[model samples]
Target chain A: MVILFPSKPSILACGAVAGPVERKSVFYSFFDSVIEDERWGQKTNEQGHSQMIQEACDILMKKAEINNLDVDFFLSGDLVNQMTPTNFAARELAISFIGLFSACATSISSVIIASLLTELGASELAIAGASSQHNAIERQFRYPIDYGAQKPATSQWTVTAAGYALVGKHNPEYPSIIAGTVGKVVDYGEVSPFHMGGAMAPAAYDTITSHLKKRHQKITDYDLIMTGDLGKIGLKILKAMFAQSGAKQEELDVLRDAGAEFYGDDKAFQAGASGAGCSASVFFSYIEQQLKIGRYKKVLLVATGALLSPMSFQQGETIPCTAHAIEITME
Target chain B: MDPQEYQQLEQQMTPPTPYLKNVLKAFFVGGIICTIGQAITYLYVIFFNFTEQTAGNATVATMVFIAMILTGLGLYRKLGQFAGAGSAVPVTGFGNAVISAAIEGRTEGFVLGVGSNMFKLAGSVILFGVASAFFVALIKLILVSVGVLEW
Candidate 1:
C-alpha cells in the first residue's frame, strides 16, 4: 500500500539552507539596475563556498533517514553539468533514478513527482530534492569575483545550499504534495534571452493564477505564497504583474524570499537571489521552520526557471521559459 | 529483503563519510576545479595578453566547452563527486548541464535530437554577456560624454 506525506516524518525534521545575506542590499540595487539599466559584472567565487551545498544536502538527507537505496529514485539537479553533486552522489550510492525538472522550481517540481508516484502506487518511498551550489553558480553563470568584476544592481547573487525532503507517509497532516499548477511559456519579444528571467515574475504570476483557478482558493487563503527567488526585481515585477491577474501584492503579507539576500552585507549585490538552490533550500527550510512555529496553514510555492537557447539566441530565440507551482498543506 | 539486508543497504546508501569529511571533500574538490580556473586565467594573460576582464569573459566560453565534453564522456559526475561546487560553479558547468540534457533528449531524435536542444541555455549566457556588454558600452559612452566617469 502506498501512502503520501510531508518529506519529513516527525514534522520536526524539515531542513533548508540559505547562506547569510541581507535583503536590503539586493532590493535597493535591483530596483536601481532595472530603472538605471545598471551594469553588473559577473560574481566570482571565494573560498569555502562550494562545500556549502554538498554539506547541506548530506545533512538533510541524513536527518530524513533517506538512505540512497530506500529512496526508490533520486530526483534532483544542480546548476552544474550532469547535475554533478546529485548525479555523482546518486551514482556512487547506486541509486538508479530519473531526473526531470524546471530550474529553481526543481525542488517543488520533484516533490510533485514524488507525491504522484507515492499516491499512485508506483513507489512507497522516494526522495524529491534539489540543490544549488553557489560556487558552481558563480563560476558557471558569472565571474568568480576573484577576477574583481563589479556587478550591476539587477544581478542576482547565487546561493550555495541544498535542501531535501523525504516524501512518504510519515505524518498525516503535513501532506507533502497537495496540488500544483504547471506554468506555461510566456515570452514577449521585448525581453532578451539573458533578460528572460526579468519577466519570470510574470511566469510566477501565471502559475499562481493557474493554481488559484484549479483550487478555487483566494490569494489570502494560503498562509504563505512564496515564489522562487525572483530576487528583488523579479519579486517586485512579479507582484506588479499580478495586478493584471487581479492578485495584489499589497494585500498579501505572504512570505517573500530571495534566498540570495541571505548573503548579507559586505557583498555588492542586487535583486535578491537568483539560483535554483536559492528557492529550493529557502522553501524547504522556511516551510519546515514555520510549520513548527505554527504560523502558517497553507503554503504556495511557485518556482520559475528560465529556458533559453544559444541557437535560438543566434537565430535570436527570445528566452522561452516554463515554471511549475506546488502547494503543500502543513495541516 | 531481510531486515539486516535492508539496514545494511540503508547504511551503504547513506554517505558513510562523516559530515565534515564530505564538506571538506567538496571544498577541496571544488578548489581543485578552481585551480584549473586559475591556470586558465594565466593562459589568458600570458598567451592572449588580454586584460583580466577579457580573460574572465573568455574563461566562461572556454570552460563551458570543456564541461560539455566532460559531460559527454560521463566524467563530470565523477569530478562533481570530488568537487561539488568547483565543477558546477563555472559557465562550463551550466554547459555540461544543458549539453547532457540535450544528449539525453537525443534518444528521441538523432537528426533533430540532442543537437537541436543542445544549446538550450547557451543563449542566455551568451545573451547575458552580450547584453551586459552593450549596457556597459552605453554607460561608458554616457560617462565619456559627460565628465563624471572615464573609460
Candidate 2:
C-alpha cells in the first residue's frame, strides 16, 4: 500500500557532505559542506565513513538549529556490513537510533520512514540520513582502490558522500513530504555484479509502477521523478521497461536519475555514482534546493538498491533488488 | 511459469561474459607475471652470487613483500580487476589477500584487530600448504623406505 501522509510532514532542514570527487560534480553547489579528503583524517576507511555520517548529521543539526535533545529519533543506513557506519554515527550522536539497510536506496527509505513517523506523531522531530564512502564500499562490494583494478564502463563508482534531513510538521517554507511506497525485493534472476544497474532496474520499475497504480496518478503529475543510482545502464533499462509497458513519451520525460544528474559528463564516474549516498546527497542537496527555490513543486524520489553480497555473488545467486518511493511536494 | 523455466528465461536475457577474450587476457597477464618472476630470480642469482634454488626463494619473498606494499597502496585490487585470475593465481595474490585482511582489521587494534583478523583469509592457505607438504613428505618417505625411490 502507498503510505499517504495527509498531514504532510516537512523536511525543515537538510545537510550534505561529499568527498573531493563528488564535490567536483555539478551538484556540488547544493551541499552544505564538502570535505577535500575522503579519509576525513581517519586511519581506516570504515572509520572515515562513520566520521562522514556524524559530520553530516552535525551539519544538519547546525543548519536546522536542532540538537540531539530535540531530535526524538534518528534513522539511517549505509552500504556496509551491519550498517555499521551509520550505527556508529548514531552512537556518537547518542540519539534514539534505528538502523536500516536497503543498500544504495537507504536514504530515501530512511526519509520515507521518518516522514511517516513524524506524520503519525511518533516524533515531533526526526532525523533521516544515509552515507557511503568510496573506500569503505569498494572494500566491501568490490575490490580495494589500491588494487588499481580496471573498472568496466558498466561499473558505477560509489559516491563518497553523506546526507541528512530533519522532518517535522509541514511548514509553507519547507518542502512537504506527502507519501511513501515501501518497495518489494524483486529478483529478475540477474547474477552479474558488474551489471548492477541492470539487476536493479527491474526493481525500480516495479516500485514506480506500483506506486503510480496505487495512487491512481501519472508520472507526469510530478515535476520531477527521480530514481536513485540507476547509472546509465539501469536508466536505459528503466526507459525500455517503460516503453514496453506503453507508457507515454511525456511520462518518460519526467524521469531524472540521480546518478546521471549528480555526475553529468563526468567520465571519472564510469556509469555514474552508486552507494547509499548517491540518492541521499542528490535529494538532500540538489533536489531540495530546487524545491526551496519553487522550481519543482512535486517530486517523486525513488531510491533503488541491489541487495546482493560478495558471498552471494560468489555462490552464483541472483541479485535481489528493491526501490522505495517517497513523494515530496510544495503546498 | 515454473522456476526452472524462469531461470532459463533469465539466463537467456542475461548478457554472457566474453570468455574467449577473458581467457586470452588472463593467459597474457599470467605469462607476464611468470616472466617477471624468472627475471627476478636471474637478477638475484647474478647479483648476489646465490644458487638458482636460493635465488628462486628470494624472488618469492621479494614478490610477496612487493604485493603487500601494493595492496596497502590500493593498487593491487585494480590489477586484480583488470587481469582477473592472472593476478590472483600468483603468490603475490596470496600476499595481497593477507595484507588486505590485515588492513581491514587494523582498525580494531594490533592484537584483536590486526593479529586476529590478518590470518582470516590466509589461514586456510597456510593450513592446506602445511598439510599437503606433510602428506607429500610422508609419501616420499614411504617410497624411499619401500626402496622404490632414493632420497
Candidate 3:
C-alpha cells in the first residue's frame, strides 16, 4: 500500500549529522525511536523521535536549501503517540503535507513512498526520515526504573539518534529505491507477538524468496540480502527457515537489528529490539557505509515493520508482519 | 568509557553458562513469567469480577509492577543470573529497565534528575511505540479504505 510520499524522487543530495550527545546519538539521526540512556545509565522524558526530529529537520532544511525545495510533502513519523514530535517538527519545517506511518521500517517506508511517487511522476523530490530514543522507549513499554535490573545476555539496548536519506533522481552521491516487492503477512498461525522477530523472519524470507522467484534467482544472486530488523533469534530462525526453503547457509551478508546491538545486553532480551525503528537505523547506517565503500551492488534492502497492537496481544493473537524489498543497484 | 566499567559491563553480558543451561533457565523463567501473567489475569477475574479483557490488563499491570519492584529491590539480578531471555523478553523486563532508570536517576537531583531521567533505557520503546502506532493506524486506514478490514 503506497502511502503519501511520491515514487522514485530524485535525491538531489543527502547529508547526515548528529548532536553533541555521543557518537551513538548519531543513530537517532536515522530512526524515530531510541532510548537516551544506554542500559547502564539513567533515563529522560525526551521521546526517542524528539531528539531525532530536531536533528532531522536541521539536516533536511540544510539539504532542502541545497536541493531547491521551498515547500514539499513531509512524510515522517516514529513509534510514538500521534507522531507528536514528528508532526511538531513538520510544522516547523512548513512542509506541504505530512503523512505519518508506523512501519518500524521507516527508512524503507520513506524510500518506498518517495520512490513510488517519483516514479509515477507525482513529484520530483521528497524526503523520508525517522529517529529513536531508548529513554522514551523504556518508559513507554515498561514503567520507569531508576536503577539496574538483572538483564539477560539476549537483551539489547535501544540506541538514540535520527537519520534522513534524501530522494531524487539517481545520482552517484544519493541512491534511489528501485523495483520493490511488497510483503504480505502469512500467518502459518503459529508465530507469537512476544516472539515478533521470529514471526516476521519467515515473512522476510518469504518476501526475499518471492522476489528471487520472480527473477529466477536465489540468495546467491545479491551481494547482500538485507532483512529489516530480525534480531538474533529472528536472524537464526530466518536462516533455518531459508535453509528449509533450500537457501544455502553461506550465501550473503545480512545487516540487521543494529540499534540494540550498540547498547548490548544491559537493556534487551532475545539479543534484539522490538519496535519500528530497529531496521531503519541499521539500514541507514549500512546504506551509507555500502555507498562509501562501493561494496554495494544490487543490494536488496528489505525493510520490515511489525503489525501488532495491544488488542492483538490481549486476544493472544500473533503479530502480523509486512516487508517491502527495494533493490538498490550500482547500475 | 572507563576501562574498568566497560570491562564489568562486558563481563555482565557474557554468559557464565552454556546455551543449554541458559535455554533451560530461560524456559523455566519465561514459563514462570507467562504463568505469573496468567495468574494475575486469573486474580483479576476472581477477585474483581472482571472479564477476560479487563483481567488481561490486570495481568500486564501486575507483571509491570512486579518487574518494577524487583528492579528496585535489586532482586531481579538473581533471577537474571539464572534465567536469560525468559526474564528479558517480556513486558516485565521492560518494566525493570524503566524502574531501574528512575532509581538511578533519583540520586542525580530531582526535577531534571529522576523525573527527567525516568525513562532512560526506554526511550526507543516509547519512540517505536508511537511510531508503530502511527504505522498501524495508517495500515488500518488503508485496509478500511480497501475493505480489507472493517476498522
How high is each candidate's interface RMSD, in Å? 20.6, 4.2, 13.8
**Tens-digit per-residue lDDT, A232-265, candidate 2:** 7678778767876787889889987988667887
lDDT of 3 by residue, A101-197 (tens): 6456666667677677667766566667665555555444433433334444434444445556666665655554556676776444432444455
Off by over 4 Å in 1: A1-54, A143-150, A173-175, A190-197, A248-250, A259-267, A309-315, B1-151
TM-score of chain B only, all predictions?
A: 0.60, 0.89, 0.79
Q: In angstroms, give how far residue A293 of model 2 lies from its true place.
A: 2.1
In terms of DockQ, which candidate is stronger, 1 or 2? Answer: 2
lDDT for each residue of candidate 2 in B75-130, tens digit (9 for 90 to 100): 78867777877887888988887788888767679899779877766788999999
Model 3, span B21-119: residue lDDT tens? 778878888998898788888888888899988787778888889887787786775676567678877888778767776675664577776688767
Q: Give all candidate RMSDs, comma-separated.
A: 18.3, 3.5, 15.9
Docking class of 2: acceptable
Range of the 10 consecutive residues with the lowest summed lDDT in candidate 1 chain B: B6-15
DockQ, every prediction: 0.02, 0.29, 0.11
Question: What's model 1's lDDT at A107?
Answer: 73
Q: Mind sharing the TM-score for model 1?
A: 0.58
Model 3 score (lDDT): 0.59
lDDT of the candidates, in the order given: 0.58, 0.85, 0.59
